[model samples]
Target: MRRAAALLLVLTSALALAACDRQAGPASPGDRGRLPLAEYDMPEDDVRVVGTARWTLAKECMVRLGFDRLRDLDIDPLPGWPRRPAGTGVVSLVVYASDDFRYGVQDPEQAARYGYQAARVDYERHYREKKWTLPEYLALTGEFVGDDPKSVHGHLVPKRGCLGEADRAIHGTVPQDRKDPVLDLGAESLEQGKRDRAWKKADRAWSACMRRAGHRYATPTDAASDPDRDREELEENLTDPEYDLNQPSAAEKKTATADARCKRRTGYVRTVHAVDVRIQNKLIASNRAKLEDQRRWNRDAARRARDILADRS
Candidate 1:
């Protein structure tokens, strides 16, 4: 049941990321070096309004089904949206530079104050104790029915419960079948940037910097996933049974700090961003029709969401 609930949570989060939109203006001539606009990206205000409305509707549906305990549960912004830097009109290098850097331990001092392993311990412990019944979980996730056909409770569930109801109320239909062009474009652009000649030069510079610092890495990804850090973590776990495996150890912290400094010294971030934006702009130009269609769909969904919320109010 817990596993099923976790899967539902993952699905819901994915839906939010793919379906959510924000309003964006046309790119200025001076912004030619920036990442190309995906027509579907919504303004932050629209995202917040739509997100809150969906949460409210879901909560109301759950309450109608006699599940009131969920009223207190917090609904987080869609993944990647909250982390986006403002006014950049892009997910910038700062995302990898600040608190979110090196898997959320960007600063050694911050890591020391709040060890990595300790962050999610409370949430993990709470969920492990079986917080919700299987039926309740299914209903909340809009999959009220169990997967098995022979189950006794199979006939008692609705085809779509609270979450699906909320989606339908907002978008006329659940956007389960739609493909997210923005995510696809972002991945392709990043891969292209990695292979570009300019970025390769930057990677070599970063590698040299790391070598001078007594660490050898071919790329930023390689440096971030150094195996020595893993070995140290294993040793720590074996030596102290009470040690939290999730927490960043001293060795991991040292590696992360070095990795960050190398990134700065080599200007890898600027190099990659420039390459990525150039490649993405070309891709966007080639796929203009498809992207425009996606943008139209997103705008319609946003309108529906606004109307639904207003009617309720």
Candidate 2:
């Protein structure tokens, strides 16, 4: 579920990236290939550009307001935050947005190399590099103070501070609602995809293949999300005294490698992705009006954001 949540958030946030328009290019190649739903999702490069533009505007605002210390902070610093950092190589900060490894380690090479770990490892490290102080938090959010009595460094803090200023400049006064129909449909499609007969059959096949490979997980989720794994890892690492918990264990690598191989042998990725496509196509057909409205809002926001970024550049 956690893995799926990561991918789903990336998919839905594609709408958020639509705040700045740049038509996506060819779909990226990956284990799960490109699904039909990707036609509506923003490309990772566009998301990075738009996100960087937002971050740049906010940083400029902070510098102008004499808060240069906050310059290096990322705009969105949570897990699965999109936008690859400099020198991160092919590590995808957006996780498997372009691809579809939400079903687990679908790529044989990735599974053999990194096991179940994804970009979240590097992203979390980057996120932890900067801790937000109270002043920085206040400047970033502008939540506690009322309409008349908020001043920092003898200058009146604008409503929502630099972040709000940047947002308003790009997206105007429109509220970025979480209740988007497209996002709702995406969640629904994923949930429904799991219930599909083909999906279940593939899961069974994958499970049998895993058993043959000397693992006993009934589902990919079971293999990926075993609660005991973390506790056992902690116990094992406690004896070493120098273990990096972030690094995948030898056992994990072996298991994940097997999981990937089983998935490939059993056609799990293909089956589940097809199930999702069927489910999403139905949802999209039923919710065209709502989706269009969402897209229209995003297009307008994108135009504004693009112009603002261009001006700054």
Candidate 3:
């Protein structure tokens, strides 16, 4: 569930909030390889819903339990907060709780199979696109993408792309490595023994992140071409204590943290499929062994190429 949540959030969030989620994608490679559903029949009474291309509820069972389609949801972040430390993505809540699989299966066991299978495909694509490192993923499991598919940020997955778009704009390749002054402030607070101060800083950072999505946190770029003049001007401009990140918005402080975070620009592909399943089963969902095999292959290949490049120099 935690794995799914991380992968699902990107796709789910776009579907949930984007003014236009682009009606799924044209036939994907995996779509052609899908197995027929007629192969299995295990349930007479089960709750299931299919056809995710269009939004519909499987069952509106209870208060707030029944789902309804919405044109879109509001996603703007709170204003007057410190900007996210450069290149921070817009932050928002994402929820996905479907009583059915997009591929149409409801046989509990089969449902789990079809459901998690689809998740694996998406997951693989996500990892491939993001070029995710396993360790970084493990770190974020506790907070951002927990064990619940229903509660996540949801925009982690892309709607359509040949390969996952690697955003060099934000710098950090791994989820946790990305620029996020919100979390950074939290750490600082813990260090300072000032929980209240930390929370306040975090809130400001989040607000900034949510608003200034897609910005980069760039570092010094060799004196900005003009060299001496640029450096002198920049020094003069920054001479004031106004750049201090500890201070929140005061009509003067315009989210410096966010600016700091999003100062760099680069791009890479994000992977979708991370797990490799050997056989499509009923009860057991993911095959850790297969997944690890694929991961090891990718890691080794990348390492060798990088080593070659280093050796050349």
Best of the candidates, TM-score = 2
Best by lDDT: 2
Per residue, candidate 1 scores C-alpha lDDT tens digits across 25-140 of 22222212335654444443554456566667877776666666877656553212122222322221210111122122233454444433322332233222234455554564
C-alpha lDDT of residue 116 in model 1: 38
In angstroms, give how far residue 219 of model 1 lies from its true place: 1.4
Give Cα distance to truth, residue 226, candidate 3, Å: 60
lDDT of 3: 0.25
Better of 1 and 3 by TM-score: 1
List per-prediction Cα lDDT, in the order shown.
Answer: 0.52, 0.60, 0.25
Q: Give the CA lDDT, 0 to 100, for residue 116 in model 3.
A: 22
240, model 1: CA deviation in Å? Answer: 4.9
List of clashing residue pairs for candidate 1: 21-42, 22-41, 22-42, 22-43, 23-42, 23-43, 117-246, 117-247
Writing each residue's lDDT as its tens digit, candidate 3 over 85-179 gives 22233343222221122211213333223322333343334222222222222222222222323322322322111011211111113222333
Sort by lDDT, top down from the best = 2, 1, 3
